[model samples]
Target chain A: MTPAEDYELPAGPGRNDNWQGVTPRQAFMRGMAVALTVPGIILFASAAGYGALARDAGFSLGNSVFMMGVFFALPAQVVLLDQIARGGSLMAGTLAVTLTGMRLLPMSVLLMPLLKGKRATRWRYLVAGHFIAVTAWMEGWRRLPLVPSELRMDHFIGIGTGLVLATLAGTWAGFELAGSVPHVVEAVLLLLTPIYFLLSLIASASGEADRLAIVLGGFLGPPLYVAFPGFDLLLAGIIGGSIARFVVRSRGTG
Target chain B: MTSSLHEVTQAAGAASGTLPTGLTLALILTVISLATHEPWRWLGLILGRNIDVDSELFRWVRAVSTALVAALVTRLVVFPAGALGGVPLLVRVLAMLCGLGVYLLFGRRISFGVVTAAVVLVAGQSIMGP
Candidate 1:
C-alpha cells in the first residue's frame, strides 16, 4: 500500500492515546488555531474581495456581509452577485448560483462519514453540512484520518467555525476598505483567495489522478469557457475528471 | 419568482433610486442550496454505510470537484474580472509563480504561498505603477 493509504488506517492502542491529556474542547481549540493559519487567511481574503466586489456593484454592506454567512460557497455567492449585477432575472440568478454550488453536494457527502460520533446529533450534522465548503472539506479530509473519531467532529467544527467567522470579518473589512485602500492592494487581496484555493487543492492532492485532473482542468477551462461560457465549469470538471480517472486506472497506478 | 423579484427590485429602485436586485432571490438561492445539500448525506447514510469511504465513486466525485475548482481558479487567473483585468498579465503570472515557489519551499504550508502571491502582486504593481 502507498504511504497515503497507510496514513488512513486507524492508530493502534498507544497511538490513539497521544491525545489522552487533551480534552475535546482543547482538541477543538487546537484545530481552530491550525485552521486560522491557512484556511482562515484564504477565506478572509476571498470574502474581503467578495465584499469589495459587492460594494462596487452597489450591494448594501449588510447584504454583502449577510451573503457571506448565508451562501458560504464563495463561487456561488460571486455568481449570484454577478447575475444580479447584470440585471438577470431572479430565477436566472438563483439557478446559476445553485448550479455553481452543486459541487458542494459531493463534498458534503464525503464529509458525513468523517464526522461520525456517538453523541453527534442530527442537528449537528445538518448545521455542519452548511459549513462544508472546499476549505472545510479539504482541511477536514487531511486531518480527520489521524484524529480520534470522538474528537473529529469537534476538530471539524472548530476549523469550520473559524473560517466562517473570518469570512464575516473579512467581508466587513473589505467593504469598509474598498474605497480607502489603494486599488493595487485591493486587487491583490482579491487574488489571494483563488491563489490559496488553487495551491491548497494542488498541494494536498492525494495522488497522480488528482494532479492530472488539475492539469487537464486548468488547460481546458479557458477555451471551454470561451466556447460554452456558462457551462464551462461543469463540463470541464466532468470531462477532465473522467479523463484523469481513465488515465490513472489504465496505468494501473491507482 | 423572476417577475416578483424583478418587481421588488424595481420598486425598491424606484423608491431608493438604487437597484436592490435579487435580495429576495439571493435569500431563496441560499435556502435552496442549504436544503439541497442535506439529502446527499442522508443518501450516503442509507447507501454508503457499508461502502468504503474512499470508494471509486467517491474518488471520482472528489476528482470532478477538484477539477471544477481548478478550472474556476484558472478562469479567474487568466480572464480575471473587474479591477484585476487592468493588471498586466505578466505580473499576475509572476505573482503566481512566486507564491507557488514559496508554497513548495515552505514545507507546503498554504499561508506562506498565499501571502507571497498577494505580496508579490502588490509590490509588483506598486513598482510597475500600473
Candidate 2:
C-alpha cells in the first residue's frame, strides 16, 4: 500500500479512506442523528434556566422562549437581560449583547475549514453559519478532520438543525414550567447551562495544548477576577490561551 | 435632546416592560445582512487558505478568531449576569479550577471536568453551610 493509504489522511466515513461502507450522505445523516440525540438532555437544562431567567426578569413566557429560538446565543441573551434588569440603557444593552457575540466571527472562521466543501457553493455556508454555537462548533472541530471536505457542510447542517430544534423545544418546555420551579432548584438549574458548555469544551479538545489552555485558563481566572473584576475572564482566557499556544508551538518547533 | 443617565435607565426600564418585537425584527434583519455577506467572506478565505498554512494572513486569521472566542468566554465568567451573577466570584473560579484539575488528571475528559467542578461547588457549599 502507498504511504498515503497506509497513513490514512483522515477523511470521513465511506469516503474510501476510512472504508466504513457509508456514503457521504449516510455519514452526514448519522452524524446529525447523533448530534440531535446527545444535546437533548443538556438543552432541557438550558431551557429551564432560560425560563427561570425570563420569569425573574418579568418577561413574558412567549417572548423569552422566542428569544432562545431566534437569538440562540445564551451569553448575549443573558447580558441583554442583566443589563436591562440593572436599568442600563437599551442602546447600551444592545451594544453589550452584540459585542459579546463578536466571538461568532472567529468561531465561524475557525469552523469554516471544517464545514466548507471543495466545490460547494457559498449558499451552504450561509445557512450553516447560523447554526454555529459552542456545541456545534466543538462537534464540527472534532468530527471535521475525519469528514470528506465535500460532506462537512451537510454533516454540520444535520447536526445544527437537530440542536436548533432541541433548543426550541427545550425553551418552550422551560417557559411552561418556569413558575412551578423553586428558587433553589432554579439556581441549580441555571448552573447547568454553563456546565454543559464546559463539558462540550472538554469533549472536543484533542491536544495537550488545549488541555493546558483550559486548565491554566480556569486556574488563572479567579485571581484575574480579583485583580481586574469585570475584565478577569477576558484577561485570563487571552493570557492562558496565549501562554498555552506559545508553549505548545515552541515545543512543536523544537 | 440629551438625557441624564437616570432618565436613560428609566426609559430603558419602561421599554423593557414591552416586548422588543422591533429589536427582534431588527436582529432578524441583521442576520440577513450577515447571510448576504457570507459569500464574499468565504471567497476571501478560500483564496487565502490556498496560499499556504504558514502565510502571515492565515496566522492572523487564526489569532483573531481564537482571541475573539477567548474574549467572549472571559466576559461571561468574569462578568456573569442573572443567576450566575448571584454566585460568588471566588466560588465560581474555584469550581472552574477544580473542574480543570479533574479534566487534566482524568485524561482530559470533559464530562469528568464538568462533573468534578459541579460536585466541588456543591460540596463546598454544603461544607460552608449554604
Each prediction's TM-score against the native? 0.76, 0.62
Error of 1 at A201 (Å): 1.8
Off by over 4 Å in 1: A1-38, A83-114, A138-155, B1-22, B35-48, B51-58
Each candidate's lDDT (Cα)? Answer: 0.69, 0.55
Clashes of each: 0, 3
Tens digits of per-residue lDDT, candidate 2, B4-122, equal 22343455667666434445734643463244323333443344335444443433333332332344344445555344455566666677678767766766555556666667666
Per-residue C-alpha lDDT of model 1 across residues B1-130, encoded as one tens digit per residue: 1122224345545654555535764565467556543354444434434645466886787677667778877776776655565567777878888998987776676767888988888777877754
| DockQ comparisons of all candidates to the true complex | 0.32, 0.16
> Share of real contacts kept by model 2?
0.07
Candidate 2 error regions (>4 Å): A1-28, A36-51, A90-102, A110-122, A145-151, A174-178, A194-254, B1-93, B127-130
Task: Categorize the docking of model 1.
Answer: acceptable
